[model samples]
Target chain A: MTQETITTDVVIIGAGPVGLFAVFELGLLDLKCHLVDILDKPGGQCAELYPEKPIYDIPGLPVVSGQELTERLMEQAAPFNPEYHYNEMVEELRKNEDGSFHLKTDGGLTFHAKAVVIAAGGGSFQPKKPPIPGIEAYEGKSVFYSVKRMEDFRGKNILISGGGDSALDWTINLEPIANSMQLIHRRDGFRAAPDSVNKMHALVEEQKMKFHLGQITELHGDNGQLTGVSVKGNDGEIFQVECDTLLPFFGLTMKLGPIANWGINLNENLIPVDTEKFVTDAEGIYAIGDINTYPGKLKLILSGFHEAALMAQAAKRYIDPEAKVTFQYTTSSTSLQKKLGVA
Target chain B: MHIVLVDGHGAEHKLEALEGWRVMEIIRDHGYPIVAECGGACACGTCQVEVDPNWAAKLHEPREDELDMLDENYGGEWSRLSCQILMSEELDGLRVRLAPISVKEAA
Candidate 1:
């Protein structure tokens, strides 16, 4: 309990590229930000979804890797000198009588800011877990939902579950290092990219590992030691496999935490927001990025950037309802002057 | 509900949480005197908690964030977040501990 209260002009919740861009946008508007995130670094889902995957349509670059794009956003946001609070989820958001906001975190820390931006990409940013019974009991024990490092799995028995590109990619990745591997999926079908699947198939042909097409029915272990798993295929075939660790790649995800109950009208899971107005059902709160839903808007990283920019302008208007839109340039003038070298 | 940390790394602190809640939720509900910042998103290392090492194999993959955080952490093998842990019948006598203090940096 340190009595020191940290304060900022705005708070950006997620650290994804769009969220990072929000921090940058707030800074461009001459506002300081406390860019809080759960990752030790920025770059939200991109870090997990596609670190090396190429991304087009990011404006400026013809092609960029996800990790590179995240780095760029972090650099752009660096100018604002935003304070960082990594490894903490915003436990609660409370507004004071005077209109200022109070921020609390899961880590027992409190922060104060003028405005809040819920930039969490695609709901809450945690890996989806397997539905097998007793799985939760061994989260920190032997079962895992993610692949942290390759070395950690060396000489260890590992089982990966998922039908998506992430699972396939991880399977191809850990093949060389892990002591033994089992790639399991509930459905006989796979959602992975053709190339990745092909590669995994090639690796499987090499007789280096194994693959099981079925959903995990149970994880059997004792005293925290995972011994094996039960897989029930669509054809009523039950197979039991032995393993020291289980990594289910079945992509389960969440969105909007407690804010979902704030009475905001969400189209599906995201809050439907007007691209131009950036208004949500809630009067004071505005949404941007993957959390925002609007007609004809395809959910993508590029779309999120657009949402973030529009929402920043709209939020400024909301905060100062009496102000009129001006066509004049605000802070870019200095940058332009610098570009022209006409000091 | 109580989060029993058997690892005994940090000052043993127990929290009163709702039953049927995720282990991370209880720790988080009690102000995360233990760290679960990602909300058990398995994305960061700050929530790292060592389970009763005897039962460590039951834990699953560290996920992207958990793995990333583990790579950047002090002790890799035993570090994990309580949020990723669920409290249920199987985990009745589960023992875990708050990760070391240094890992909380930027967590």
Candidate 2:
């Protein structure tokens, strides 16, 4: 396959609020940007983890949910028409000899950019696996952590373990297609929304599927394929739940991922960035948002916004070494207003 | 001052802390495994930690906002948002365990 290469002025690694804001800031300076995210959509952790959760500290918007904040940020950057490549992660980053950066993602897409921005909020969101004995053997086979494709388990015996929204939502989504479905959890208490809980209960009452109060103790299968699982019930009884496919929604955990392999300096698992321009140890590369750390750094969206503004300035200078750059406000600068389509 | 942070794997790490710095900053600066999703704004409770019972008395009471956020996190008696706890000379040698993160899985 001929790998497609996209050449751009700025390459942002995350599509979260800060990354989106970076596009606007860079866009105002007439710089083009292409964003890549591991997630299937923008908003990073905000959209993936807690879309409905309200965030009370986004400065101007006294109260905004994570999803709303993401939408508004996208709208704010729409005039720039930043290119986004979702459902992919940047696996490798190398600096070209000519001072440009080369990046490749897990999906085989490559980008060459004059400047690179790391706005990854809390790194990559990885699925938390259930701490079951010998469970690792079944991973990627019968035991799956996430439902990337709904049709993978079609007509298979599916067992979902968790009392959270993912478990309940998948139970509802996969019940009809699954040959036999069993929803298992430690107890009747659920952390999912009330409506989902109600729907799950209604399905259970109708005998469309079964619900068990237990925890997975062991996986029963051969060579990565599962035939059943040993479940320890709340009443201290161990029983076998037969299923060919197991989906455990243990929630998500943040991993620094491939960025850790990059040669940039790291403080803890975060990138150490200079506060002046939010630039990392590497030239023409900047780290912002929760992924970057500095003295007295606050991992707030507003702080990332401030960092994006400064980062754009530094990036502009790096992209055009001999050009004179001036600071201007959108409210008064006709040129800035023209870029935003407001003049 | 220095403090000890216990990660999910039961490993202990000693880290430097500055006076007036939020506990979240110290742990985060060192790349320990606590997620302060809202930074230090006291909005998100992703930075919850269990203070050592012995040192719990030395900590200040959680404000109403912090308490409310903790309630949202289903906090217990020992639960406190690391963002709300400021480091001071008095807080030296503090040992804290990360609160197990329990997030509702979204579809």
Candidate 3:
């Protein structure tokens, strides 16, 4: 890994709606931002968990889908040209004597920033692994938690587990190119969209692929080159499913992950911050969104948006101590509009 | 300002508090045993507290979301999510008792 270091005015963690809004807020002040997220995309929970779920609490907008909200936020922050490093988890965060933060990601990327914003909503979303012995050995080779590329599964016998959108979506996506495709779950019920599930059933009826009602029991592979898998049916029959690739989507769980080790004070796994600037006990580090706790803090996207506004103001002062601070609204500030490319 | 917090064990402790901070923040900041699993989102009722009967009438009415959470997870008199209660000068003498289901009990 190269030891080169990248510098930015501010480094915002998590690319959720709040983090995306932080880009806009900080960008308006002429401070560049870089956002890091564990997921491959920008929207955190909203995009991963419930992209199509309708959200009614966002102010002004009477109704909006989770995916739409993420899209709009990304659009609003587009002019800022915020750097997004997706599919990477921040592994280390340390304070330098110079009062700036030195950060490192699991993907071997590094950054130095004058200010840091923790916009991670309820921490990082970790994939739930199935209960199979020695499954770790096959991970990253034949077994995968998420599909990053469709071409990787091309011409391979792929067996996908789980009944969620990820499983069904991948099943539909990889069907055309795979040598053979099979889907397995505990039962016939699926938590995925009905339309997708229907399409999967239609495909199965046409003999394009196979669907099995069973749970993964064992792996039939050596040295990570999966040859096949053992499946135990609900009716107590054990059978082998031939496949070289496995994709399991058991859903996701939230964990504070490495953020708990950053020397920041955590109250029951949530960061504590002051209401004024939403800054944590650690100087130069600000916590916004669901990851932060304060008196009367509302863990809503709208509340995070408000916190991002104040956080940008405080972050500006921290980055430029001698600079004059002026409050300007997007509706009235010509400079802000120009930065947004709308003036 | 100072506010009184009655722990789950019925021990009362007074702590310094800020005027604009949330009651949940004050409790958590002092290392009080409360679990805000969802932070202040009002989605998880882990931070539930029973406002002192007398003070309940003095505080603002719970919001619609707050009410939905209370109705869904907790149904007790004066039960409120401390995160939803903002501290103010009028709330200086606020007295809140920890509900039966705190982070400790839930965990």
True interface contacts reproduced by each model, as a fraction?
0.00, 0.03, 0.00
Off by over 4 Å in 1: A1-3, A131-216, A220-228, A231-256, A317-327, A330-332, A335-343, B1-107
Candidate 3 positional error at A214, Å: 2.6
Q: How much RMSD separates candidate 1 from the native structure? A: 16.5
Worst 10-residue lDDT window for candidate 3 chain B reads B68-77
lDDT digits (tens) for residues A1-343 of candidate 3: 6978989999999999999999999999999999999988988878875576678899999989889999999999999999999988999999999899999999999999999999989788777666678889999999999877888888999999877678889999999999999998765666678899999999999999999987788998999989999988878889999999998876665678999889999886789999888999988999999999998877799999999999999999988999998988899989888999999
Q: Give the poorly placed runs of model 3, Cα more than 4 Å off.
A: A1-4, A133-142, A147-158, A172-181, A189-209, A217-232, A235-245, B1-107
lDDT of each: 0.68, 0.85, 0.86
List the pairs of residues colliding in candidate 2.
Answer: A268-B30, A268-B31
**Better-scoring candidate (TM-score), 1 or 2:** 2
lDDT of 2 by residue, A1-343 (tens): 6587999999999999999999999999899999999888999878876687789888878899989999999999999989999989999999999999999999899999999999998788777666677988888888898888999989999999877778889999999999999998765667678899999999999999999976778889999999998888767789999999999886665678899888998877789888998899998999998889999987788999999999999999999989889889899999999999999
| DockQ (Cα-based) for each candidate | 0.02, 0.11, 0.04
DockQ of 1: 0.02
Q: How well is each residue in B1-107 modelled by candidate 3, as lDDT tens digits?
A: 98899997789999899989989989998998786655565655668899999999988887755664453332355788899999999999899987755545321
TM-score of each: 0.54, 0.79, 0.68
Model 3: how far is A226 from its true place, Å? 6.9
* TM-score of chain A as modeled in candidate 1: 0.67
